[model samples]
Target: MTPAPFFYSIFGLYLNSNLAIPGLIVLPSVSKVDVQVSFNEFPPALQTNIELKQKIWWVSRYKDENDRPLVTIWQLENGDYWRWEYGDRTEFIIDRKGTQIWANWPNNLTLEDTVTYLLGPIFGFVLRLRGVVCLHASAVAIEDKSIAILGPAGAGKSTTAAAFAQAGFAILSDDIVPILERDNHFLVQPAYPRLRLWPTSVKALYGEEDALPCLTPNWDKRFLDLTQPKYKFQELPLPLGVIYILSDRTTSPSAPFLERIPSNNGLISLISNTYANNLLDKKMRATEFDLLSRVLAKVPLRRVTPHADSENISKLCDVILEDFHKLSNNV
Candidate 1:
């Protein structure tokens, strides 16, 4: 007999999976299943009836030994399905409706290896396919609203969020932030209850290199556990209050500060930091442009430049909370 499927909730969607996904809070049962994931054996090559619409050259920074793209995606069945191929011989098929996912991998890899991609890029693309606006950022819930930390990969987005967690704030989402516009404001959905951080950031925030446990035995990434009382994880959506675009660290003597940016520049930043951005087709791009345009008009955008010292995470959080409070008072 087959084992019972696992139920999980994330990005405001109910998921029923054939395998238990790590880092997610498992629910005993869900009222409705919005997405289903199954693990099955697949051949080395896939055969499809529909014509291939488009092939994304590459989506990830890593590349194969041959210098080719580490990951490639094929839009199939006239956008009804998406096929992903990885350098390590892992594969996944997702429906455009975002309701179904099937994954297969080689014998050498474990479920944890596939899960890293599944939880981040795979689900992020699923959200995009479902018409949700997502950013490659981390979000933290303050008093009544949340703030999204936007930046490039090494720009300290997770580090800043970890600092906020230490300061007694609730983390809404990490890595992939899903936002829904409701009641004339954007609300951020809560992701899982952990923050993935590099060793450098972990040392900076917690004063030790091994402050947090490894996310997976195969990976060097560490994760800050939000289930601990020291950290808070927000389960409900919070209206987005502010957007902070993190700039590169500054070694100058000045303290950390926020710089207000123009809407046009902010829009460029938003477009640049969108999740699964490389896979967006013309129509999807248009939809994202319109949604972000509206967000720019309504939300306040600030550029935060932090000190070069890693231990200054608290100072960075202080400036951010000060600005967040000031904005709240003005509103």
Candidate 2:
């Protein structure tokens, strides 16, 4: 009798890499990032294993051209992973093997440069998928319940999340809060231990903003390690209390401050605010839509039109807190 092809679990999802692709083995270790992939065909790269800082489990496949490399970085921490593919003629599968880094880079590009460029986005995407549904907006916990502040890229999501963090509410997730359906309830998961904020918002929140770690030398964004300050980075999931879709009302100053949209409209709003919809296909989109519809059925949804200024943070938080309290008491 033949044995089962693959067997593993991450964040409760059963992974069968061998079944999905022949000649692939994904082994993830506990404590520190360490992953080992065994390919029946390709031999291990000799000098490549020395350069990695951590070991991450990964799976890769040859594209139709047999030159492009499609890779997935499986980081054991938080049970997260990401899938990416390089162009034809070069393929690299970089992952952490415990504290040591591992890579399968094509001979053309230097391994160091590829790791540096792909690490952040790949990590971000992995974290986003696992528990945090990276939204294009910010999130705040009000009265122990999370209120998502939704909007476009520069619509102050990070600003709002930071302000709420400063105002004593725990930061549930920033940018993305993965919304999952479990027995009729929606669970929001925090994406990462750090929050990436624009420089302007950093200065606004911390005053002398030089303290934040620069993600890139010239980029306007910085990464703040929330774990350093003892901010509760939720490892388990939390029920999503409210969805507040934020829209800048500077152009329409006289419009109502807040309005409750229909559940379907709210679902559309939530879908529009997703951070990685581009990667989703029709089937995935439908699945997400179904999951979101069920979520909206339980949680109240609101549309908040606020003037894009400093004051918006306080006002929005205040309103959300009030609503959260009302909901909790009723529940």
The lDDT of each candidate is 0.87, 0.54
**Candidate 1: C-alpha lDDT:** 0.87
TM-score of each: 0.92, 0.63
**In model 2, where is the ten-residue run with the lowest total lDDT?**
16-25
Identify the runs in model 2 with alpha carbons over 4 angstroms from their true place: 1-135, 208-211, 249-256
RMSD of 1: 2.8
lDDT string for model 2 (1-331, tens) is: 2223544332222333223221112435223222222222122443344224223344455444555445433333232222233542223332322111223445555433343333334433443333334455556665556677788877777777776776766766666555666776776755445567877778777776675876644344676666656464544566778877877756455432677888657878878987666555465567677777777778888887766565455776666666667767888
Clashes of each: 0, 25
Q: Residue-wise lDDT of candidate 1 within 1-331, one digit each (tens)?
A: 2334799999989998888888899899988899888876432234544234556534678788878678888776566678898888788888878988889888888888888888898999899988998989999999889999999999999999998888899999999999898989898999999999999888888788898898777678999989987789999999889999899898877758888998768899899999989888788899899999999998999999999888677889999999999989998
Error of 1 at 229 (Å): 2.5
How far in Å is the alpha carbon of 202 misplaced in model 2? 1.6
RMSD of 2: 10.5
